[model samples]
Target: MMTFNARALVPTIAGFRDEVLASRTACTAAFAAALHDTLAAKLDRAVAALHEEAETEMRLAAGKGTEDGDFLYEIYHTCTTFEHLWMESGPISILDEIYEDVVAEGETCRVGLDYTVIPTEQLGEIGGILDRIRRETGIEFIAARV
Candidate 1:
């Protein structure tokens, strides 16, 4: 199993979050447009499609509301894309995760997560994300940061 010490990732995570948050206005504007176009019932699916387009998935986010769903959509904002910002709880969750990482000590920190757990096929999808982010914003992100 590949293990990461959260301390090493603090800057990267924070930097990533900073970049995401820095673009919050643009992301929210686009997300708000999408949200405006989508129906509440299909919001979860819409979010899923956004993840697909972004080529990344949100972990620990269980979409909750009138109907329960297989994919976690309750909490959001783990990923850098715009999908998470649509949910009310997303920004908070990201901030909370960052806070936990910043304060917690060895063996307690959970932010320095590894992606080997992500399936193989999805790796290619994620690679596309890296390419786009680099091509568009010049941010190295976690994949190429090292």
Candidate 2:
């Protein structure tokens, strides 16, 4: 398993949180506008007894809320994406079942985490785990000064 030190994730997670916080207001406004546009289009087509299932589905997906009906789910998700790392209390095992290349020792001394090296799917999965951890503990992870 590829183990990652919690400190290694600091920069990427902090950047994600900052980005979400920065664009939250704009994202919310854009989502509302897109939803309104979709509804208008649907109404227009309804008058002619026609509908675009794909277009409606796309709009709904884009505007879908979080588990608790939060409109800015993406922002919230990004903001809490690295919560797991802070609370891990141990190194993160990327491949939990495998132990062929575990690097449990000297993990903290490593530099340049480069989170972008990880595939998008795996990163999203990690983010989901972090989100769950935050929700369960009701703790917001804040960056520490080095």
The whole-model C-alpha lDDT of candidate 1 against the native structure comes to 0.33
What is the C-alpha lDDT profile of model 2 across 5-24, one tens digit per residue? 22334344444444444434
For model 1, residues 1-146, the per-residue Cα lDDT tens digits are 22212233334334433443433434345533332222222333433444453333323223334354433333222343342333222212111122224344555543442222322234343334334444533332222111
State TM-scores per candidate.
Answer: 0.22, 0.22
Best by TM-score: 1
Model 2 segments beyond 4 Å from truth? 28-146
Clashes of 1: 8
Name the regions of candidate 1 deviating beyond 4 angstroms: 1-3, 28-146
Count of clashing residue pairs in every prediction = 8, 0
Distance (Å) between predicted and true CA of 102, model 2?
34
> What residue pairs clash in candidate 2, if any at all?
none
Clashing pairs in 1: 61-72, 61-73, 62-72, 62-73, 62-74, 63-72, 63-73, 63-74
